[model samples]
Target: MDASTVPGILDQAHRRTTAGLLMLVTFIAFEAMAVGTAMPTAVAELDGLAWYGWPFSAFLVASVVGMVVGGDAGDRRGPRVALPWGVAAFAAGLLVAGLAGGMAVFVAGRALQGLGAGVMVVLLYVIAGQAYDSSLRPRLFGAISAAWVLPALVGPVLAGLVTTHASWRLVFLGLLPLIVLGALLVLSAGRSLTAPDSPPPPARGRRWWAVLAGLGIAALQYAGQRLDLPAVPVAVVGAAALVAGLRPLLPRGTARVARGLPAVVASRGLLAGAFFGMDALIPLLLTSVHGYSPTAAGLPLTAGAVGWALASQLQGRFARVPRERLLRLGFVLLAVGLAATVLAAVPALGGWPAYLTWAVAGLGMGFGMPSVGVLLLEQSPEHRRGADSAALQIADVTLSALSIGLAGVLVAAATQGLLGLPAAVAASIAVCTALALLGARLAGRAAAPPRAAVPGAGTTLAAS
Candidate 1:
């Protein structure tokens, strides 16, 4: 049985703390799903299709900066200090996005929003790791997964409705109340946070991290946006910038996606890329080909919500589950889900099959994401918690940016017909998903932990 099921695995204080933190999840989901749905309209009306990938890409690239900032902030000020700043920054980004009239301004808003989301997400993970006992972690992770189900169900539809009937501007504007509410809840738990056993970060050199992180994400995202520039050259440059960014943060082997820590980080990137890449493609395909209206097309997203929720519930229920098994399960579901999605492009079953596949892929991710968190926390040093957490996001956002950018390229090239977009999307995702499965398997089979990275690009992150 899970510890949470026991009479007192959580004290009153812990329950309050859990309640407070969960609010963050709820708002994050709302923001994520709504932004996604509203984006199609935002770009179409704003005449930002030329930069359609920017808002998402910018957020992802900026998230790298947020990770560095959040890690440094968490190490020095604690999650309490770092988290609110993240929330406030994110809210400000939304405001910027809501008001932007042009693509450049919109991109800037996304960059800032990315920074905020990255910081808040990692800090929240840190808080969850620190606040709960080991035995209770599964339930916590499960709940985190469960949180997505609702927003998945409601968020896209709401965003679609808002976009069709009201205003896409409201998509950003509407998030204000929930964001405010969630932050207040976390703030209320301020007194209960325990101290990290590690000393705070060395104060003098910390500011440079912000610049490094920003540059790193910008370069990596640019590489993703421009991948067809000869695969070797693109990989060479992309690899270089990615390594440069990692120099200070992760362990050495991680950059190569090596045996230990590198593999963990790589797995995170691969899976996230696979999921987000598909997500970036879906609305485009549905609206362009199936004659579905924006609101109607968003139903595929809801399928993901269902898959994520059900799978998360199972992750928690199955207590003896190994980290390896969790990891493997994640890849399998993802591969299967993608396969289902790929089937959509096959032209035999028509459209509904594609929707089914997308949902399955989402469920795969819900099972996988929290499991990765469990692995990272189990291995992280308390002092390095912030850095490790940030690295995970860095991997996710970095890969996601690349994947989405590539998807965009495919859509542009394949614009000859309606079928072209889905075909390109499916093909690109298939490559990433297959690669992700291999990475996951290697991670599960490895006996030793990942080694710590020296401070340099290609610096490998140590497996905990």
Candidate 2:
């Protein structure tokens, strides 16, 4: 169904469900942005540079496991059981990470935290898919997207200040209450939801063991970058691990250039990696070359956030159109943004361009990210929702690590060595742009014709 035909927000009937879902989404984004900002300081204090990747890695790996468990539990037992469990796990992780001391100890704490956060995140996706009717889905998601705007602006800087002054540990410890509150918000909606359990799922996809392998290999990839590990070994190990992990999780034809649900999932990873990999470099660039404070480096991302929010609202209007076309458009914008940032290498235009370029990338990203999200939800089976959601996150982080890790090499070569910082960043941006454009084409191929229209897909926008 065409999204343009849906009812706008004020005209809609279901206000409570939308409120709960949006609240959940906003909280998640808030937590994620806050954590990203604070971690650098936390790492410095703990002197855990060697294991720095683990904190984020822990969340991601555990989230993969949680996706499967939560999806299964939601499908068989219902989101009621899954959602609360998710919140509990995420909070537990936060509490532990906050209290941890020393690098090794902190890494352990992060691992536990990630496991719980993973499950909770999947449950949230299932909740979003299940609770809101079709017509409301897009706008609800858009609002969630909008919620991220300010957080991007403020989250990093605040995290920087907190780490620099009060306590980095406070960031995690503080989030504990918010996690509990978010869980309660969902729980309060009704009698706790519960789906009937079914027979056990077969191990044909990226199930229990495979998830560990995927994450392990991803960790190794990060290790490669951190320690100057050789590329051959890193690629060999990472490839082997990913192949093992993807054996069951992805739909057929996913690894190759292609179309369909599986392809959509894979493309999401590429796009995510391209953006995140490049994004990781942005702060480093601002701090090192631009001579901006950490908080100042974060400001450019805020512009991206603004662009991200504005573009999200327009997606429902484009929903009925071909998915690939939209995907391609998003990539084009990203490439353009990257191109602008690349110009930072040139001395005459360096200063202001640093801040302005990302706005373009942000806008392009805003257009593309939600489209993929709606597609993932649309394709998920009630039973597979958890797995799909988990897969989506896993793909995002895994690729992000690859992109970011690789950027370290390029940026270092350009800045640390002889090529020069601006030139190095330009090279880095160029690589990301190339990958993003390629991913855009893949998204195009993957964009299949929608199935028969839903009764209310048109009405989804009625509330806008």
Candidate 3:
């Protein structure tokens, strides 16, 4: 049946899949949101002041490799084969990190979690492509985005409270049981999914490239932590490796922001880089510069998340409003929010402004992020959905890492007395704001010709 005649996502036919998917996303979202709040305390306790960014960088680097392998597996044997392994790896990583006493072991566990998250998240797109119709896809993505809401509202605060009163270890250890439950639900719901009839293209080359990309990011992260001249050579090498690695992994013309799928892919990177680059630093900015407690530091994140969820729901409800317009608006808001957030760095302005500024940025992401997913799926050929999904995610992770690393370098400069903390933070926000504006400029390129409408679902948006 076409989407118009199909049951709604929460209806009997789709209830299990929808529930399973949302449940899984929620758990992941909680972990992601909570990590930022707990990280400072965790690093301090472990006595790893210089290694602050390594945990996050390790996760992002490992995720690239995971996405490559997971995409191949999903294409070959479907989500059934890929999903379980991803869950296993993620669980193992959490266990390791939770039990660790040192920074090295903690980072190692985070790497494993990144690998598992990479695999499972790619399969989510694969599953959506396989099981849902075009019309349903928008709603699915919207719901997926909304899954972050509850986590956003409470995850950071809860993490902060737990880290303060209890052990930070509980933050990692707490999620293990929930992970198993989500996996069981998704696996059971996905039992009917199967691989394509034809063999997929060879993934060997892509896998190798992904590894190279991971190494490159790791090098860059290392360079970011170092303030001396020795970091220059490492940064150059890392840049070269990253460029080489991304050439084959992303869509053709992605670097140049070519129209259609290439632009869509590029947009994801830019948007992610702009948003997450600032996100990872906000808590640090507040606690270090403004003297906010962990719980207080997490409030702005909650505000952003709330904005994201609300905007996603509205976009989903008004699915026919033209996704490109929403994307453009999203970028504008993100740019504005990011730029305004710089005010928080100035002691005269105070830290309260972050809540509002970040909320605006979150609204932008709420609109932009899901629209990108829907557009990609709409443009992707059925057989190549896994590969394309991998590309989209690769862009998100790669750009986010680069942006975060850039901010890390600035933070290092501050630590080493080369610049003031406020200046470093402002500089990082400025860069991210520019990226959001770039995304706005390229948003139209992601559009396609409108498709024929379903009876009451309304016309699909396309480039005029």
Candidate 4:
């Protein structure tokens, strides 16, 4: 389509592309929400209760590798190549998982799925940067966020139904065709687009560093889950490995939160870490403390998803607002929401009040997450987009893993009677709250003047 005739995301010309992207996102969202529901049954049937957490850990670690490799490939060859491969791998993973007779095989399948998911996420962002102009990006992201709403609301229920009537295997088997359908849509959209000229291949050394980083992240996740072991030494080794590997993978000065793009990247991690840390705990608090059923406990999560969609729509509608301002507002809301969730630890406020509090946290995520995405695109040069996108994902995933790991340790301690449940919950939420406030502080640094650009990179934004 000509520039003048380029239609909106919902217009006829863009309809197929939009539908395909949304459908892909919907399937991913459904799997993410549904897996937790089916896991209990899967473990029971396989007699793999001892290995319950390995599936999740394996997926997460393998995803880090996928992101790194996908980003490099996208920068060198284009997202067109990366996207289809990711979809194929994801589908294969589903088949493997569905057919598995044992836990080890199931974990391997999950790792493959995670790898594919990581690749897809980076490619999707690259696709968004390439296919849509800046004017259309916010709406596209908003739509992506909206796609999660339905899955969040019904995915678990649907998984439970399938498990009860047919088998949990259907949960994996059923998604294979949908993956093919989504891949077809993406490939069709890709046909009309021209690939950007490839940049010089990255140094072989950088690729090695990426592999090391992925391994480190995996080690850290494994260590976190194994807190029952000698905690101090395991944690120390994990931390050292994570830092050593992470140093070479990110932009220079990211560890120090250097102003501009580095700080923006750091802010994404902080926001994700704090938000997801709290999210992981909310259901536990409801079911264990408040005596709610599993389905009933999930209602707050549904409410949170609604709040997220609503906020995303508002940000998309008011695209004129400065992204940094929205980010700051989002962080403030997150901090407040986290603080409010601590009320559930209080005996008098344990039930319904917690739901509203968690919804506010979700609203913050809706605002902050998309704004970070927009800023990443705006800040990155065409050649660096893939690497920058990968960095963003790495930061988000690693920090979230660390945050949840720490919280798990605290919860385990409480369960063993080393601390009161109320105290454990309070302490965990407090740490997350502090991180949210820190993110708000970092948002200002992110808005500062960009550092000197590398040769062939995009022009830096001038400080207003």
In order, the Cα lDDT scores of the candidates are 0.70, 0.67, 0.85, 0.80
Q: Best by TM-score, which number? A: 4
Counting only residues 3 or more apart in sequence or on different chains, how many pairs clash (N, Cα, C under 3 Å) in candidate 3? 0
| Native RMSD of candidate 4 (Å) | 3.1
Ranking by TM-score: 4, 3, 2, 1
- Ranking of predictions according to lDDT: 3, 4, 1, 2
RMSD of each: 4.5, 5.7, 4.9, 3.1
For model 4, what is the error of residue 329's alpha carbon versus the real structure, in angstroms, after optimal superposition? 1.1
Error of 2 at 405 (Å): 1.5
lDDT of 4: 0.80
Worst 10 residues of 4 by lDDT: 455-464
TM-score of 1: 0.83
TM-score of the candidate numbered 2? 0.85
For residues 263-300, what per-residue lDDT tens digits would candidate 1 score against the true structure?
A: 66667887888787887677666677666687667778
User: Candidates 1 and 3: which is better by TM-score?
Assistant: 3
**Top candidate when judged by lDDT against the true structure:** 3
**Estimated TM-score per prediction?**
0.83, 0.85, 0.89, 0.93
Alpha-carbon error at 25 in model 1, in Å?
Answer: 2.3
Candidate 2: lDDT of 252?
52
Over the full model, what C-alpha lDDT does candidate 3 score relative to the true structure? 0.85
